[model samples]
Target: MLRTLLLGLVTLAASLVAPAAAAEPVAEPGAATTQNPISSSFSDTYADPAVLRGKDGWWYMYATSDPLHEAPSEFGLMHIARTRDFADWEYLGTVFDEADRPAWTTGSSFYWAPDIRYVDGRYVMYYTVTDTVAEPGPWNFAIGVVTAPTPAGPWTDSGGPVVAPRPTGNGDYFNTIDPALLAAPDGKRYLYFGGFHGGLWVTELDESGLRAVGSPTQVAIGDRYEGSFVVERDGWYYLTASSANCCAGPVTGYSVYAGRSKSPLGPFVDHEGVSLLDSRVGGTQVLAQNGNRWIGVGHHAIVSDVSGQDFIVYHAIDRNDAWLDAPGGVNERPTLIDRLDWIDGWPVARAGAGPSDTPQPAPTTSSSLGIVSDDPAAGEALRAVAGSWDAGTDDDGDAGAVGRLVPADGADDAAVRTEASAPREPRVEADVRVPTGGRVAVEVADSGPSGVSVTVDDAARTLTVEATLGPRTVSDTAPLPSRFDAGEWTSLAVEVRTGRATARLAESRLGDADAVVGVDLPNGLARPRPIQLTVSGGEAQVDNLTVVAAHQPVTERVAEPVPGDEVFAEEFDGDLDTGWSWLRPSSSVTVGEGVLRWPLESVDVVGAANTGPLLLRTPPEGDWMAETKLDLDLGSGTVRNYQQAGMIVRVDDDNLLRLGDVAIWGTRQVEFGKELDENGALRWGAHLGGPVAETMWLRIMHTIDPATGEHRYRSASSRDGVSWRWGATWTLPAHTEPSIGLYAGGGATPATVAAFDWFRLYEVR
Candidate 1:
């Protein structure tokens, strides 16, 4: 009651400050702050953050529903806050009160992931309704909208869902939540929504901005992306989404990734040309925890300062103080702000520096920033080689000039070559229509005899990358999404960097796609060469054809195993050691021949059951690392509703971390899972990594956050035991002795045994 009263007083005080009539033409920039987490003015968890510059000149921020403080009765109904400078914020309570929530929403329903936008002269906010009064269970998620005269006001709910609860082709329904609005320049409004259950999708909204109008198009694949946000820069549409687990107490691996396309609705692809829908999954990392005080950096909003510099406003967990009160309680994610930079046509948080922990300059608040292009225009420094190519106007009904190349009666290829030498690492792009039955090709890093050629077969709707050596040619083909229309102007691109070449076919003028489908070339280009564009068998008009130096390689950095002193080792050659204990002892587990064989169980430790037995053992006195070699193969490309076996670190059934090679759906992955109790409810969070082998090595490194003495554990796995893949880290409470162990389960699969070669613990170096 005290907390509620304090919040009411604060809201009333904030309301006294009148809105600015108009933004200043040249506003003064805010003073630099000493460090990040610019929203540190507020101490509560503010997850799934969204920011909108109000007409009154202040930037209003909204977050998912949660209690403002430790008081359970003081829940916030989608909290709201505002700020003049991006650093210090003023909490203005929440958007809804107990009596003002949507009528369709039940008392237990939680509002989440709010997206605020001003369209058609009014403020429109779209949010997620976790469960409605009419429908319940299995995640009956829907998108709800509300409108108000101003950023803060007496808003009116639209009465019902803009996006009704939807079902996937499978028996289960899609997790339709996380709605983001993009008020396009062409008087069209597109809403990007959905979550881990249904993937990310985009649908056009009616003029009223309250209902969906057209069929929705899937953007990112399920189990990979959520919290979809779209922003346009230099004519390219970037789709940024959060990945991994959002809530796992201290172990949440939530991070942000991005992909871009030319069209508002697209077949978006990452920097390496990987499609978001591909099973291998593709995302250029935007923000991630870089071994700092912060973790789970994701679900962000991008805003700009008056000076045009961009800033990413998101939430992150401080390793030292990860939870509200109890170890397994609600995660304490606070809003943070950092500079967002664009590198070579791609957006990276802090110029790929990851999260910040030091003093930084703040954003200027007086005006608005717009997108600016740094890339040079295309079709320059090029000359026709095979056919008479002439400059033409608007070939495909679009308002733009195009280079038209019509091959003669029997000509095979109408080619154009760049007069200037191409860079050693070059990216070539062209916007051209696929002649009814012919093909369009872009060749990069080409010498006289050898080069990489990317061809798009319009008839087959396939993108192929072929490497040509004196007499040898290697190629790989991937089918394009049906949305890539041959009748429309398609953007084709090929980027050659390092030792591989990537080919992409975009619905826009040019872009990237599925990285897994890209092909490896021979030693890259030894010398500078010329790029070429070819049209075969028919006449095609090309626009925006350019070749420029590609950016430095963008790849995932594998975590190196920390060296330490050996403390404990179990070979499994003898009967159970006295150090090991089991939560629910199972007779199916055996020990012999230097191995421990545990058959997959039909139990789980998540949710309410908590019945899966875990083999338990304590570690050394201080920070330590645990290593284990497991020979468990759940098979490849098969549905095994999950059979897994690996190492685990636990404080109990409710709060623990598990890393195992498990088969989920059709994908075999290395899963890092966290199970915790949130406000008396079981909450499970997980993130996945891949390339599992029949025999693999898994390790967990544990340390303590010096500031708060919280226990931190990081996960790593290796297919060959030589190179390790480090995953996100999770945390435990201070001074607590959580046991480290091994377990395997997640029913519905054929019998399989998890063979353990050894278990070892070592003191931190």
Candidate 2:
């Protein structure tokens, strides 16, 4: 799967005369700078990228380039870029050129697969520079080693290929390329490398890291693969590699696959126990074509940040922006970066999809949350659609300011539309403030069969639903109590449900009131229409205005649930009774007071698709019942949305049963049902929520109707941690098999404490 990388067209006319480019500019989180292929002023053609943060604090990135790129005959082979932040990058120069070629090999033109290592005092780089065209297929390339005092090298080569291609045991095939090294628990270094038509090879290397000690051991897999990268986490060795045609522009079917082994070498299999060699069968798919806008997504490097969060840096040819069609870009391999989360025993990016278009959490370089400014122009959340806003200002009026909207005497400039919300209705929210006689109102057009315009005006304290041009059939009105306070901020929201509309207002979460009326917006305005805001005079400042498809309001009451026939149950006396295994370790997990005390991190179990949580697994499945009583103690921090912990049923990472608290700002809501990340790297679930209790009994039941061969899942919770009242049951897609587990997570402040009294599993008798 070797194809030419696109980034080698430009060569600085100046060689060793000047050092590679360097700089220090950082972009705030969620800024456009974090977008895929990120921002690089240096090179658009960068590919086969290998990034390392140098001792100087600048991230130095090296990559392969077309040997044809015009440069000094003595110029280095790999292209380089350096940056203080990951977003803005400055292009550096080559690592080696023709004049710096290894002695054993004649002058070479082709160079790719560059890897860097900073050990002891000097820097070591292993790269593929061998011209294998003279040999047969199955990739007959070898790697060479070079050393220099710094990542920005004034180099010296090992004089020859440190690892070269040789005949296999069958004496028929051989492979040698894409070298990567692992510094194992032992004092020795293990070199991992290979390519298409060749099995991955792992060999022991001396501390020098340039020479192999003995013959290499070929790691077993099903088929040919390349770009071998091995990393060890939690005593597990994960080998990730790229397979198939990695480059061919839009049609390229390249993808990344991974498998884990206790030992660094030898056999590795996917979740299905199928050999990675048989990728067609299964091999923990890491990233595949996102299909929305990106393609040819493969040949990646997995590296971790200071926060221990992993990132997958790779090159992909954009569908609309392919480099081959661009000037001087004969190949179109553009580099991209995405966060990678280790789930179960494998790594998964957003939805296991190749590259996501959805905005991701800002790159986690540090453990703390990176907060961007709230100024509308600088705010990341409000970047989608800048409603007709002229300018903004604050007390300083220097820069960071909220967007100011003023209605013209007679013009449509005061209103603008954004993405429309659906299913039930749109959740429109924004933090607004008015001076003296000013007002801000939001209006949505409903083009549905039975729709009308719904407007909420705080200044007038009026909640109105009217039909602009219709038979004037549906209508309703409600008074907003103390809706607006001059010169003060207001949290405004409108939940437009079919046949009914509810408007909620609050200064904070406290002192909140809702105004509900049986009035529907014109169904004819099915799409997002300009939110009509009419200002007679005065001016208003708007900020934190966000529009999302919010969950429906919960209206369930606490009560004892009806119990079903019992099957099997566990009441902990001392330790975790046999069947339970700690799938993931936490800081402290102890059993006492007839409970399993679990303190979850600030991360929660959102859509059960991308696995990560404090999970305790049990081997039980099918038409079964798993019930547990959980008592959540705030410890030091309060629960927030995507926080709180509870019981879950799992088949794997992508498909699972989750029954837990989905909180926002310490307000608790219980969400129950099967959750999956099947929709555009986002969680797509058909679930419902109810009030949450600190001490509640959670139950998940999977049932089957033997006659019709139908399977369904039901969930319920009780305030007493005993009896539970079940909700509407939902059937999962056919092949879903679920195992029971207890999960607690909330990657946030103060941490979380959840203690489980006992867990019991039962099958209908």
Candidate 3:
């Protein structure tokens, strides 16, 4: 679908200026630090960014056809940029000028969402051809391919659409945009395409990698996803796609979600086992707008550094100065980069801290560790030292044969040492299955048993790591998450780098960085030494043993709300506070016994029909957070369209921001919605955030955007009111002090009541 262009009334120059200077910077993981909007130094609007490392060793990024930092008149072609260090970027101009567009396209056809890859021998570029001359229809989006010698691209079109437009018989059609290619492990080139219309899909490509050779399979449902990017990792194909409104200026709720399946063409599912095609929708949040300066974060590309550390490059709009000119103008989406940490088999940006507004450690551009890899399954890297070892197939036949070591004779420890030399800043990883009451230890950079040793105990279900050097020892022991079963083949890794050591465990055969369990090893040994594996008690089978010197920096950050002094609060001890006012008052709303209760009525404050009852109170000026604990039961796994109850920030009946536990179709979601006047019409849109429960705490963090004089409200919810899940942000126009309140209405089915424990507002510190 062609994105609705909300043209900003402002001119080009003002939008190109740098963002507001950041406050005191927060440190990141590496030696040199950088911040997000990494492309802002070069271009202002680099949307739908696709990044790849070139043969020239520079990382090149391509964007949808849009001006770098100017009016539309300056654009009719794709944009490209290059970076040596992600911290510094240089504009490389368009991939093709208007005069060089494909001959099959009309003058009005636009190119978008470039997917670049080095296929076979040369570089291949797959992109969206909107309004192709052959289709002769509006929104005739199709996938097109172009060949180039290198990433810079002196290119040539493949002469036809790779995937043609498929009309759905009605006036509507399935969109064939946002092309992505994944080279599967089985040597098949799978092309993933489609958008919010017709959903995301995957098809096998011909050996030439230019045309689809098979029928497509849907990866995600329509109306929920677009801009699909798939990556295969550790036997799982993870499909990441952008969701929600992509271009709503400052109010844009564009975010990224992820699902994975073992098959390239899959019934992909989220971590919860919910299929992406489910009516309720199932996707793990990958990148969403936190309460930072950046919003509308989506359409991402993942790149791995030399050390195997991953980075996510995407685009985001500055909520403060969102548009290039006026409110509905071109959104200023600058490219952003953050560490992509895999926690418990899922990829989360910056270890779940979301996007960074402060300085962060730059990507490790150079390898500081000199390492080697060894596969113990081949029995080539290890020699039995004090054990009776045998090579045999593991319990899981899919994992192939492994080295099984058991204590021989009367010895309590069975040990094997690697033939390769020790490594600097070493990380030792393996897949192992330990018998009950048994324990397995992986030691790296060892000086006898005095280096760094990670032990996994089956009976206790614990992961213990001890780092010792010259009698100084740093040790930590943590119980494994319930998912870990030592009796099954599990992936484990232990690493020591830069005076710190971390140990990780995954329940499955494919190694997952499940958790970050690290300790400061001030006197730890990082010098080169042979790796050693030992088993005691019973027996343990190990396979795929890999030892590499990875000097990886910690990337996870803890998210905490910064609250100032209390501003306003309602405890509902007896009756409504004198400071409160009611809009469309309802008899069902009652305050007593320390709780305010209201039922889900048939009325609502959506579109032109604004009849829902709201208990409103004016909030303090400037930044603040409004929180409410709501207990609303709408049942689950059933159709409960629009029934909701939670907090609301209201301007009038048709203009407001709402955070509610609402039901849509068959799913229960915490929806953060915004209703506003767009071109004299009432437009309502919402972005789903954190999961929802019957009893949940809803919070809306409001901050003033100094640049645009806009109000930014970000949603967060908590099941236990302790660890909050921050979601997307919605922007409201300036000069309006919206009344903060509570609203419950949408459905009257079964007559359910919403009990709110308390309403509290705090100044943002």
Model 1 C-alpha lDDT per residue in residues 352-429, reported as the tens digit of each score: 556767666666553111101111123345667887667777633432556677786678778877677777776665
Ranking by TM-score: 3, 1, 2
TM-score of 3: 0.67
Q: List, residue by residue over 364-435, the lDDT tens digit for candidate 2.
A: 332111112244434322222223454466552112356666655564235433333333445555555654
Task: Using lDDT, give the best candidate's number.
Answer: 3
Better of 2 and 3 by lDDT: 3
Q: Report, for all candidates in order, the number of backbone clashes.
A: 10, 38, 12
Estimate the TM-score of every prediction: 0.58, 0.44, 0.67
**Could you tell me how far off, in angstroms, the CA of residue 722 lies in candidate 3 after the best superposition?**
8.5
Clash pairs of candidate 1? 34-359, 251-730, 273-513, 273-514, 274-513, 274-514, 274-515, 275-513, 275-514, 491-509
RMSD for each of the candidates: 13.6, 24.4, 12.2
- Cα deviation of 146, candidate 3, in Å: 1.3
Highest TM-score against the true fold, candidate:
3
